[model samples]
Target chain A: DAGVTQSPTHLIKTRGQQVTLRCSPKSGHDTVSWYQQALGQGPQFIFQYYEEEERQRGNFPDRFSGHQFPNYSSELNVNALLLGDSALYLCASSSPFESGYTFGSGTRLTVV
Target chain B: GESVGLHLPTLSVQEGDNSIINCAYSNSASDYFIWYKQESGKGPQFIIDIRSNMDKRQGQRVTVLLNKTVKHLSLQIAATQPGDSAVYFCAENPSYAGGTSYGKLTFGQGTILTVHP
Candidate 1:
């Protein structure tokens, strides 16, 4: 009965470096969506993946991309990161039959 | 652009007092709305939700009221406690609803709620 699990609870990276965050969806869930929350701001949708393919995306740039594995796990990869990329990255999972989506504690990315 | 926003940036209240958080949404077509509470250094936690078809829905100590005509939403907390101090965000799902269509969410700027004892 574990909820969503995200790896690398915290990360520090340099500008222009790349980072990949991992997420394991809750049991009995199939859809995974990634979001970015800046300081003192609500989360902004980055993208969503279903059936191993990206079903929808937000207004983020090409540098932001994601992948959904057959096991329903997900990975969010950010390339050419900038200091503005420093924020909390959250992963949420949901099922079609369920109305509520469970979110992980999130990875706090600090770009130095 | 579709967006959701709260009326206030911050609110302070005495513990055991009722608290109401208001939000205004730009998308009239949005059918699903949700409220999330996030503690420091943690992800947003789901509090409650209400669909357009319903005017209000109540959870244990929370109540979400939807005003479709005005494109507004509100979350009411009964007898707030210190543990309720956190940032609250109201999110709208503009995509198709029901089944698996629940996709990426558009969130507001969030409101900081401080409950004092």
Candidate 2:
């Protein structure tokens, strides 16, 4: 089975511009979560989408939002991007009953 | 103020040698723990995981030990290979309730493991 897949492996955006990253979760997985990994740092949780609604969120700002579709795909949108927003955006998928998660290769977002 | 952090920022070892990476978490209520290995330009891959009830868990060539009293965790790799070189991260589920509820993850800063051939 194909693992988690993310589109636009790499992206470059201007400061203040908005960007949207897409993710396709692994088959048989329903929950999708987004994480932001800064340089030399581990990923920080952004928010998680389940049942097409946001269930839990991290300490991120309002500019960060996400959506989950019926097909289990997900999209992460960051508005008013800052240079600090330049990082790897990773998407993880898992079943609610499972303790482990599968991750995508991630989208390398660069804000200039 | 809950957070997960690593004790070392980097580790170096020769190929075929065993390697160990350590982490500490501030959340005492965490019930589930996971170790992830991340390669450059990639996302975190699940290495292994253990619950609060279990003190240790082992996989193909990796082992995870959890100390609830000290709130510390460790990952050990046996006969490490060059391909095992990557950034290792430890994450915890602070609100793990079991069943069909998915818990959020709190990740450590991560330790860079270098396996020299």
Candidate 3:
């Protein structure tokens, strides 16, 4: 089965511009979560989406938001992006009842 | 706030030698833990996981050990290969927390493993 897939493998945007990264969870998975990984750092949880609603969020600012579609696909939107927002955006999928999660290849966003 | 951290930022092991990466978590109530391997330009791949009740869990060429008392976790890789050279991360899920019924994961700083041939 295909694993979690994310679009726009790499992106470049300027400060104050909004950007949206997309993710399609692995087949048969319903829950989708977003993470941010800076260079030489581990991925940090941004938020999780289940049942089309944001179920949980990390300590990120209001500039970070996400949505889960009925098809189990997800989108992470970062508004008023800062240079610090330049990082690898990873998408993870899991079942609510299971502890294991599958992650996508991630989208590398570069803010100029 | 609680967090997970790694003791070593980088590890160098000879090819075919076994490798061990360690992590410590501050959340005592975390019930689930996972180990993920991430290669360059890729997302973290699930390597293994262990629950609070289980002291150890084994997978193909890998093992995860959990110490609830010290709140420590470890990942052991046998017969390490060049492909195993990557950053390893440990994540914990605090199921007992008041929010997030799905149990969100908090990841460590990651350990970079370099397999030297």
Clashes of each: 0, 0, 0
Report residue A58 deviation for candidate 3 (angstroms): 0.4
lDDT of 2 by residue, B1-117 (tens): 889999999999999999999999999988889999999888899999998999999999999999999999999999999999999999998777774537589899999999999
The 10-residue segment with the lowest total lDDT in model 2 chain A: A93-102
lDDT of 3 at B60: 97
Give the TM-scores of the predictions, in the order they appear: 0.98, 0.97, 0.95
Give per-residue CA lDDT, model 3, range A1-112, as digits (tens): 8999999999999999999999999888898989999998788889999899998889899999989899999999999999999999999998745558899999999999
Q: Write the per-residue lDDT of candidate 1 for residues A58-97, one digit (tens) a residue.
A: 9999999999999999999999999999999999999998
lDDT of 3 at A57: 88
What does candidate 3's lDDT look like per residue over B8-115, in tens digits? 999999999999999999999888888999998888999998878899999999999999999899999999999999999999998722222374789999999999
How displaced is residue A112 in candidate 2, in Å? 0.8
Error of 3 at A24 (Å): 0.4
- In order of TM-score, best first, we have 1, 2, 3
Model 2 gets an lDDT of 0.92
lDDT of each: 0.93, 0.92, 0.91
Residue range A2-99, candidate 2, lDDT tens digits: 99999999999999999999999989889999999899988888988889999999999999988999999999999999999999999999886666
True contacts kept of 1: 0.75
Candidate closest to the true structure, highest TM-score:
1
**Regions of model 2 farther than 4 Å from truth:** none
